[model samples]
Target: MIGALASQAPANAGSPAVERGQYLVNIAGCNDCHTPGYFLGKPDMTRYLGGSEVGFELPGLGVFHGPNLTPDKETGLGAWTDAQIVAALQTGKRPDGRELAPIMPWHAFAKLTRQDVDAIVAFLRSVPAVKNKVPGPFGPNETPTGFVMKVVPPAKPK
Candidate 1:
């Protein structure tokens, strides 16, 4: 699967694969959490793919911000290596040695072939970075408060 995305990855410019990645990024629900303020509206197109902050005040959840997912030189994944990204999604660890908390659905994503994952990352790399400062790695699910985020229900294990 890695070959599929890499095969179509545009070298000098954004390729069709990257565009597809962007589409998947949205369809896969990456925007819901990675992009904060989704309740109000999408982030400015100028800051497409930029991360934001939203407090998770539910019982099992805690206050946290969705950090920048853009390719900005400063507050984004610009400095991260593809390996770092793949590892984070597959292993739940940040480049800084921090656990990404279970909020991010890297589990479901982890099933995707390496190539597809790369395409998503490729699309992320192509987007302009936003200067949003995400807050925390809010641990645990909030079962109390009015909010109850349904995590991916379990499927028969392979």
Candidate 2:
């Protein structure tokens, strides 16, 4: 199923690197969390990788939305350099010196080959920029303004 999806490249996705990246992004399930309306059974392909309207709520970490990955300067990764993107993927550290939310699986991505990582970056760079600004990385005490999928720990047996 993923293979079929990866076969259809985005309009701007050209070059070997971009294609490879698109494939990687699809197979890696980047859309599962990043694309808006995805968790709600409707993925907005028009705003692909443009960030999610829903957030994830960890017990003590508060809610975090899947941020926009498109290259829009005002609301997405446009200002981030290739190195910054790579670092965020591999190290779970944002360029602004903040650690990525725990929901982000950067540890697994850390094992990706350098070439693969570079390809992913290329693909991300080539996508059409979306102007969506996903909501917060709200603090534990703060209230989130959007829908959230909470992750609750299993209860201990008494």
Strongest candidate by TM-score: 2
Candidate 2 per-residue lDDT over residues 125-148, each given as its tens digit: 888899999999899999999999
Highest-scoring model, lDDT: 2
Q: What is the lDDT of candidate 1?
A: 0.65
- TM-score each candidate: 0.71, 0.94
The list of candidate 2 runs beyond 4 A from truth reads: 1-8
What is the per-residue lDDT of model 1 for residues 1-158, given as tens digits with 9 covering 90 to 100? Answer: 22322343333345766877766776786666666555345434444446655544434555455568887667888889989988888888899998776567888888988878888888888765667656544456432322224344468989
lDDT of 1 at 104: 74
The RMSD of every model to the true structure, in order and in angstroms, is: 8.0, 1.8
Error of 1 at 21 (Å): 1.2
**Residue 124 lDDT, candidate 2, scale 0-100:** 89
Cα-based lDDT for every prediction: 0.65, 0.90
lDDT of 1 at 108: 83
Candidate 2 lDDT at 126 equals 85
The TM-score of candidate 1 is 0.71
